[model samples]
Target: MRLLQKNKPVIRFLLTFFGSYLILAFLYNLYLNNASSQKYYPEFITHIVALQSQDLIEAFGYETKSIPSDYDPSMRIAVNGDYVVRIVEGCNAISVMVLFLAFILAFKKDWKSTLLYIFAGLVIIYALNILRIALLTIAIYEYPEYTDLLHTTLFPAFIYGVVFILWFIWIRNFRPKTSPKDV
Candidate 1:
C-alpha cells in the first residue's frame, strides 16, 4: 500500500502511456487487417510513402519505380530496373508514430501545444521515413553487400533513434513542469 501510494504518479503515467499505445496500435492493426483484403500494391499509407520515396529517388536521377508485387503483399521498389526493397506495412513507421504520440500524451501539457506537437512530430517521422527509405533503396542498389546491415540494423536504428530523441525532447522540454496540485 505504501509503495503503491508512493508510486501513484508513476503508475498513472505508465497506465496512460500503455493504454494509449495499445488503443492506437489496435486501431492501426484494425486498419491493416481491413486493408489486407484489398488488392492494392501497398496498403494506403505505405503506398503513399512508397510513391514519395519513388519521387525522391527519381529526382536524384535514378530510374526508380514503385510497383505492386504479384507474389508479395508489399510494394516492390525498383531502382535502375532492379528490385531493391519491398515497401511493407512495417516500413510505413506508423507504429513508431503511435509510440511517439503515446509518450507525448502521457506527459501531456496543454491540449493546443500537445496536439500541435503531435502533428508536427508525426510529419517529421513520416517525412524522415520516406527519406530513409529513399536513401536505403539507393544504398542497397549501390552497395548490395550491406543490405542486411543497412536494413536490419542501421535504418531501423535511425528511425527508432529519432523517436527516442523526440521522446526525450518532450520529457525535457515539453512535458508538464510540475505535478498538478489537484486532480
Candidate 2:
C-alpha cells in the first residue's frame, strides 16, 4: 500500500497512457477495417500523401507521377520515368500520429494549449513525413543500391526521431500542470 501510494503519480501516468493508446489504436483499426471495404478508401490518405510527395519532388525539377498501384492497394509514385516508390496505408503516418496523440493526451495540459499543441505537432509531423518520402524517393532514384538502407532504416529513423523530439517537448512544456510547490 505504501509503495503504491509512493508511486501513485507514476502508476496513474502509465495506466492513462496505455488506456488511451489502446482506445485510440482500436478506433483507428476499426476505421481502417471499414475503410478497406470501400473501393476508394485505400487511395484516400495514402494517395494524398503520394501526391504531396510527388509535388515536393517535382518542385525540385524532377518529373514525377503519383498513381494507384495495379499490383497492390497502394499509391505508386514514379519519379523520372524510372524510379518508383509505393506508398502504402502504413506510410500515411496515421499510426504514428495516433501514438503522438495518446502520449500528449496522457500528459495533457490546459485544454486550449493542449489542443493547439496537438494540432501544431500533427501538422509538423505530416509535413515532415511528406518531405521524408520525397527525400527517400530522390535518394532511391539517384542511388538504387541503397534502397533498403533509405526505406528500412533512414526514413523510419527520421519519423521516429521527430516523434521522439515532439514527445520530449510536450513532456517538458505541459507536465501535468502541477504546482511547483506541490513537490
Q: Which candidate is the best by TM-score?
A: 1
Given candidate 2, what's the lDDT at residue 31? 80
Across residues 79-173, which tens digit of lDDT does each residue of candidate 2 receive? Answer: 88874798898999999999998888878878888899999999999999999999999999999999999999999999999999999998887
Pairs that collide in candidate 1 are none
Q: What TM-score would you give candidate 2 relative to the actual structure? A: 0.91
What would the per-residue lDDT of candidate 1 be over residues 38-116, giving only the tens digit for each residue? 5455578888888999999998899987888788778889998899999988999999999999999988999998999
RMSD of 1: 2.2
Clash count, candidate 2: 0
Q: What is the TM-score of each candidate against the true structure?
A: 0.93, 0.91
Compute the lDDT of residue 174 as modeled in candidate 1. Answer: 83
Model 1 lDDT, residue 45, Cα: 85
Report the number of clashing residue pairs per model.
0, 0
**How far is 157's C-alpha from truth in model 1 (Å)?**
0.8
lDDT of each: 0.89, 0.86
